[model samples]
Target chain A: MSQQLAVGIDIGGTNTKFGIVDRRGNILCDGRMLTNKHEDVNCFLDELHQHMSVLIEQVGGSENIKGIGVGAPNGNFYNGNIEYAPNLRWKGVVPLASLLEKKFSLPTVLTNDANAAALGELIYGAARGMKDFIVITLGTGVGSGIVANGQLIYGHDGFAGELGHIIVIPGGRLHPGTGAHGSLEAYASATGVTNTAIEFLSTRPEVPSLMREHSKEEINSKLIYEAAMKGDPLAMEVYEYTGQILGAALANFVMFSSPEAIVLFGGLTQAGDVIMKPVREHMEKNLLPIFRNKVKLLFSELKESDAAILGASALAWEMKD
Target chain B: MSQQLAVGIDIGGTNTKFGIVDRRGNILCDGRMLTNKHEDVNCFLDELHQHMSVLIEQVGGSENIKGIGVGAPNGNFYNGNIEYAPNLRWKGVVPLASLLEKKFSLPTVLTNDANAAALGELIYGAARGMKDFIVITLGTGVGSGIVANGQLIYGHDGFAGELGHIIVIPGGRLHPGTGAHGSLEAYASATGVTNTAIEFLSTRPEVPSLMREHSKEEINSKLIYEAAMKGDPLAMEVYEYTGQILGAALANFVMFSSPEAIVLFGGLTQAGDVIMKPVREHMEKNLLPIFRNKVKLLFSELKESDAAILGASALAWEMKD
Candidate 1:
């Protein structure tokens, strides 16, 4: 009868973050470990369990925990499995939810990280009262979660809401990961921003830029943001170009479901007005007249690192007793 | 009491089709009138009333008719109004449902034509038992209805599922109606097919075939289909181009909602394999690995003329008694 808490786990390509969260969205305790270091999925689960156990004990042991929720790349909600995730070391389908269920003797739920983020927004973040909205995470790769009528769109196969991969520029830029051409992720994400900076520096060599000070390998979204902050024209144009594409893609999404707002999350949003102005301008320029000026484009209210774990945690609260 | 019937009306740019339909999808009687002949909406309603009255009486009067359902361009389901529809002569927001209810002394519902087609597909067409699917109307203009989790996605403003407007080839072609560039409608509709044929014929005059006989004005989707049927390589390439763009757009749609199937309806589908082969090939090619080959691309089973009325009629079945 003690206050129940939920264990939230986020299994990213490089890091696995775990947290003990109360119903009020507070992370009581948390920790992380390198995800790729464990070659065997079983070893990964064992390491995750060892890390989570200490947090569970701090919150007064397993009795206080309601269940576990996990968010990962290629995670399937319908079947609690991670299916052929390219980023992870596991080469094939891995029964992650059941493994955690058995290891902790608790109910477990799993969904793609984007879906978890959407749920987090619905329950605790900016989309709290809205019935229709989209959450786009502009991190190393772009990710999306679409919510309509207050429910997450898991699609028929639990793999809906992959806005990152939607082809924006028909034969424009090539996404190395998905082999997709002109995908939103190719130009809107952190990696995309870095690539845009490099492309601009090389293609427009006559245009002097602060970004040229860094080598191609040394340049990233953060460095570009820093340069842009210093009123660097070339670095500012990188965000302008990235935002233009992101805005166009967002316009296409708006026409699809007509969501009330689009919430942006992750690192690339750090560019602020430099990016958002173009995103808003181009998104409006591309939308059908009826949808223009209607959808609110907002940045995430949740903290950077805490959002993934919190979003993953939000899923645990939905687990049935 | 006698078996109940529903009155269905489809208001198109040129033609207005209306029918009295039974619960089992049988049309007892139907009629058509010119939609633009009467500029005033009231006059149009009066003319429609005079035509529909005979059909309603044939089905045993208003008492036996459960309700009236209407499908029109730019129709809003939540407000039961037709708002600024480019195709319709009724210029602004017309309270169509209330007007119909007032005139006929029966309950009435109104939705966009595409959404109505989706309902038609759900209740009486290829998507009868499917919980999630998309219905694309490839007519003079492209329109779409998206169904997810056994419900139509009405979005926040009841204007959801405008897949036709989603920019497939950004900055590629101009949609004269919506003024957006490279929209799916600008490339995949019947109009788009003709435009593609014109572009091809003019650009590749050297490698010619059967289509040169017709003037630019004479070129249409039907003419191109006939030419392609006669081994016209240039004409066949028109469908190939249209389908490729359509297939790519469908791929983006599949990623959005991950529907079980995509049901294509309208004039272009009459070409059968010529259009379908490329659509399927390109759609599968563009899809991410997980979604590839999983979604069934189907043609609408409903008869072209009857489908509009049938789809509109299906909405009446949901009316509150």
Candidate 2:
């Protein structure tokens, strides 16, 4: 086991996951806390500090920790701040990295959750030794991180890779979250799958569907996936539609940066070939001649339970002087 | 003049322009040759060598030349080959850079013309000292070069930034060149401008304009610009629609890479505020709040007659080793 370790923290809307991680991406110690319980940001920081101290002691004190890396909803790598993250309930910008650094007396780095996931892949997952690739998370909302020329692309403002917002179908689906019409998030996210299932039921009322028996309030993505597994035709059609939309968008992304692989992660990938097959077919069909068969579609190799912690710690490791 | 000068060559379908350029971007001597005259690439190269030898002697000799950089239709920077260029008579994968290196005994590098133009902007024109930006050429067809993290995004393949081929409208317009439906190039290119005018005339027969008088052959982007300059309503509407399409696409591009600036080049920019106003309005309207009003929309600063040569030479200078 590597004696050197970094602390990784992933701050979500409801909870925060923290861990002490080795260079090889093992989470030696871990903790979690309710993020929204404390209304004040400083109180949240104090809670975070208290928990970190315990983990630091377990790893033989602060000296064993090289630095801290944080992944949050609106984290800014350049400024080390989280600005106007709607889900965080914090007013304006939060200088989370500075606060952590001041308390721990160690270096700290911050990046958006998707960017952290990308760094995680680069350090210890599928993207090891690869110079160019993209990681897309199809969870509640869609998120992405772009890597090119062996470096994370932190554009002019430290927020370059927002692939979810790219309009895949003009005047098509409307995103309920961001109000951006025709976004990839509107059709490919977990919520998008549930919403698409709902839309299909209403639009095709005359058609028979297993989903129709469950009603809109009861049928979620999990229910839809279960139905599809049971060979429900309407449920299968929903996955196919979602996959086609996602695949078409992925084709556009390939045209933009031409990454070697596009790694899909999160709840939606659980549908497996029900989604991947259509995505592959449409992405290949839409790609230009030069890029037709070159790009590989991959799944996240990192363990789901430990990925966020492992990914964040990788960024911390990079901050070593 | 500096004793060390790089040779820049711009190979087009019609003509081949070559020049000796100093570090300060000044063209010391220049020459041109008809490209299609020779069916064979070697014959074309020999003629080029004959003319270049005269210009090389005018400065100093082969010793004075630092290296040769070429900008061609389908130039591949990795392999230094022009691969399957539809416009060029050269059959599959002509190793032009290697031939130039063998004959001149100098370091030679080649890249796709748009990428060369991006290097030109970075080294000698608008994008100096900038870390992230995009250069878009809106001429016969829409072409782009993306720069992020202070380097051009070449993706996994040598060709990465083919922003023109991105599907914007989904099923809107069919690209004559790539066969992709509803592409930005189909709406923003000069031919697109002409096509849009024809389509508008047919769709809204009641709409009056000077474009209707010129017939299809005579009504070009230039003629449309002149009509818009003279306050023709139909022509103005055509520009508005084109700008709207371009603006929406730019918004999507912004979401993808979050560039500091998107530099517009080529013939369409000459339409000026007539096109720029709607582009700004729609681009801003479509942009997410985080990126709103942040990205500057600028025009290319390199002089048209000398830009291609200068841009190519900039790439040559970068390949000093």
Candidate 3:
């Protein structure tokens, strides 16, 4: 029998990653292209189709391809559409799954990127053997995918698991994407860390730190992490505060999901104890007595590139069955 | 064929309500008894067993009893135990379901009151015909039950859906049950409303109103509602503030569960728009742009007693299937 393959695509604000994955969750061939989200979406889809064709040819032929699975910013599994994703500069709902299916003449499934990552973790990564857990991605923003009773929780409208937008600080700082004040995304994301560092620098200008060496335009979570490793007080404060907010949010999530473990993925999570320590502290402090010490928090074991593609492939694999 | 029946039992702080229901979600007969929580738990169980025996004999005898379902505080569905329920003064985990089964030689199931309530709503109440919704009970304390993907989201240990403990106000106030500071339960429960009213009265002693008549005794949420209905400004502020907190928490819930509707039950919810209006306004204001106007917030249509019994009965019906 010929080896069957599925095309997994992960769309982001700046780039789109596509891969041909097999039943074993291995990527056979992969490629990337600029999203250029500001342009017309039809043009973007056309570009994606061309790239996919080239990848298919490289991997042998379309005959091996069984289906397509996509993970995008505002993708909806039930509607098979991307509905006004802010990061993509898309307006209104676009029938993404149908368009892909029409182009490839194959089965296609779509879901929000966070849910895709969760499926990735479930099939090939940290949660491969776990039945219930929450996967949290802490990149430019905080996102989550929930698994309950061995299935992804896509509530009535297939738009569940927006953990980042939950309130962490009432009437505090404003979150970027949510247009809401005091959201968990405002305090826990990588961008949130930068904003916090800036605020901290503004308030405590007298403290000498490595952050002063970097230009304002170059200030990012990486530089802050480096400084914190060198014992920078302001950098340390940023991580502690960010972790506390994350921990508090996780405590609340425990109340709702009650997962055995909460898996952390994405860039900010790579900061290690600088972020995890405070999050655990606050979570333990805030959790109900019954739930305390019962939930575990862990870092994602999947590579970022493989995680997204694997997640999309998992969706395809699930659909195939 | 013998008619399929489900037994529902709701254990409250003051009373235990029991009912027999059919598969079509119709109640055949219902009864209630005062819960002597202050006495030994074994004695209480004996009394409960006797009452149930009498009712079962009067109705259709043991052969007609399909199954038994009990809803109580701190109940664990997975273990069929009631674990350290504060309201009931239970010292340790009690295998209530097993005990009931042994006594009656019938299949028995158990879950927390909140979870039962959510199941009730799904099977017979306002959320009938809906697969995704959250049921919240705003009584002496706030309790929540979550439904996702047409099933209760009992986490790894069967202890999920503790919505009231989610922190809505960090560093704001301490919660009585969890001892967590600034939890939604601290601001949204009936006790929370009374506490807010007391605080408001302390701040503005000059505002003479109907609340002055209750100066001799402790003020309950009922008195506050009555005062607000009589156009008292302080009482109105208390409701508005409580609703705002409730609304903010609900917004967070929307992000997580994405339920089609949130059904409010219990005594405080009876305040109607006095609580609902502010909750709706704050929820709308805080919702992400994509989720705005997509979810519904409504009061429970089932009578309090009926809901309690229906929820408990639904557990048995669900288990039998």
Q: Name the best candidate (by lDDT).
A: 1
Which structure is stronger by lDDT: 1 or 2? 1
lDDT tens digits, residues B236-287, model 3? 8888888888888888899897999999999888778888999999998888
Each candidate structure's TM-score, on Cα atoms with residue i matched to residue i, is 0.97, 0.93, 0.94
List, residue by residue over B1-321, the lDDT tens digit for candidate 2: 344789999886567889999988999999899877998988998999999999999988978888999988667788898876645677678999999998888889998777887888888778888889998878666767889988998888777887877888877798766678888888998889999998887897888898888777788888888999999988999999999999999998898788999988878888889889999999998876778889999888887647778989988888845
The candidates, ranked best first by lDDT, are: 1, 2, 3
* lDDT tens per residue, model 1, B252-271: 99988999999999889999
Classify candidate 2 by CAPRI docking class. Answer: medium
Lowest summed lDDT window (length 10), candidate 1 chain A = A83-92
- State the weakest 10-residue window (summed lDDT) of model 2 chain B: B83-92
Judged by TM-score, which candidate is best? Answer: 1
> How many residue pairs clash in all the candidates, one count each?
0, 0, 0
Instruction: Give residue A297's lDDT in candidate 2 (0 to 100).
Output: 95
Give one digit per residue, the lDDT tens place, for model 3 in A1-321: 453888899887667888999888889889888876547877888888888898888878877777788988778889889887766666778898998888888789999889999999888888878878999988766778999989898888888888888878888897655567888888877788888888888788987778987777788888888899888988998899898888988999998879999999988877788888999998998887778898989898998888988898778877844
Clash pairs for candidate 2: none
True contacts kept of 3: 0.89
**How does candidate 1 fare on TM-score?**
0.97
The reply for model 2, stretches above 4 Å from the true place, is A1-3, A13-15, A33-57, A60-63, A86-91, A102-106, A206-208, B1-3, B12-16, B31-54, B86-92, B102-106
For the second chain, the TM-scores of the candidates in order are 0.96, 0.90, 0.93
